[model samples]
Target chain A: MNSRKCLAFEIVANPAAVDALCARAETWLIEGGLGTESFPVAMLLRESLNNSMLHGSGGDPTAQIRCHLQRGRKWLKITVEDDGPGFDWATRLECRADIENCHGRGLEIYRLYADAVDFNRRGNRVSLRRRIAEVMTS
Target chain B: MTTVQVQKNDATVTLEGALTVALAQELRPQLQKAVAEGVSSVVFDLGRADVVDSSGIGLLIATHNSLKTKGGRLRVANASPEIMNLFKAMRLDRHFSVEGRQA
Candidate 1:
């Protein structure tokens, strides 16, 4: 039997909202038996949401950010979309951030943690997936 | 929130909760003030912090750069395993000291 759970929600583009949403999603994933996958999942959510709020929406609190999370027995998928003018994601993806730089590491985090990452043509939406770690069974 | 303890040229900054973009923005001035005051060695106590985003990582790198110019250094202590993994993954451990919490 395939046991998969999914959640979708929207939040204003703000730090507090992002925090709350991440916390809620973390709890939901934990309750769904994510085990060791929870931390990286939370990190992925944070980086994506933060990028949407700070860069995509320019920290406009009124901007709406949409998130969708799907947890399957072997994988977890996340998608985040922001209502803002997207950037040239192709070039951005090719460029690497210097270690000393104070910005531009958000994409690096996503790339490191997520097994697969893709951006919409407009660059305002991101979808990523991670293979869920095995959960212990009694 | 954050608390700072200073002793001559060394400072210890204790941070609580997530070190996301908002906290990084709010804490930037205080950290800059420490650098401005000639605090050469700064230790970040993240025992209470559970999460750190890219902005938070950027803040740490910027702080390290600020201190390096003064011949100072930044040390991160008592990071949770997840945070430690992040630092190591970014190769930040090569730039400065990062310690995970003791089991």
Candidate 2:
């Protein structure tokens, strides 16, 4: 029997709304037995959602951001899509170690936390897969 | 919610909630004020903070830069394990003191 769980939702491209979405998603993941995986999942959700809102939609309130989450026993997959002109994601994937800069660390966070990060050719969509530890059932 | 306490040349800022872009925008000015007031050291008490995003990381770095220009230092105390790992992954601990929450 397959016990995978999935969630799909959309939100307006607003920063505050993004925060609320992350919180809600975190709770959902925890309730679904993700345990420690919930934290990184929520963090990654925030990063990707913010990127979509700020860069993709240019903070346009009318733009809609779509998110999907799928959780299995050993992995969680997250996807975020924005309706905006995509950028050259290839140029921005390099993780920089510069601590003095206040920006450009979002991509690095994705790289460090997610086991696999993928972007569509348009760069308006990002999918992240993170490996999770098996939950021990008592 | 955020609170700032200053004593002598040091300041302690306790933050509760996710340290994302919105909170970063709200707290930036207050932190800059602390730095401008000649506080030589700033310690962020994030015991109540559950999560942090990239902008939150940017805020910390920016605050560190501001304090450094004035010969001050920045330290993060009581960060959750997940947050601590994020900071360490980004090598932020190399630039400032980052401590994990006590068990």
DockQ of each: 0.85, 0.82
Ten residues in sequence with the least summed lDDT for candidate 2 chain B: B17-26
Write down the lDDT of every candidate, Cα atoms only. Answer: 0.87, 0.86
Scored against the true structure, residue A48 in model 2 reaches a CA lDDT of 92
For A1-138, candidate 2 gives per-residue lDDT tens digits of 223378788999988788778877877777776767777788789899988888899768889999998877788899999988985789878757477999988888888889999999998999999998876543
Q: Which stretches of candidate 1 lie over 4 Å from their true place?
A: A1-4, A134-138
B1-103, model 1: which lDDT tens digit per residue? 6778888999897989888899889878888998998889989999999889898999999999999999999999999999998999899999999999999
Q: Note the residue pairs that clash in candidate 1.
A: none
Predicted candidate 2 versus true structure: per-residue lDDT over B1-103, tens digit per residue = 7788889889998988878888888888988987897888989999999888888889899999999998889999999988898898888999999999999
Tens digit per residue, CA lDDT, model 1, A36-125: 777888889999998889878986799999999987667889999998887578888767789888888888888889989889999899
Worst 10 residues of 2 chain A by lDDT: A1-10
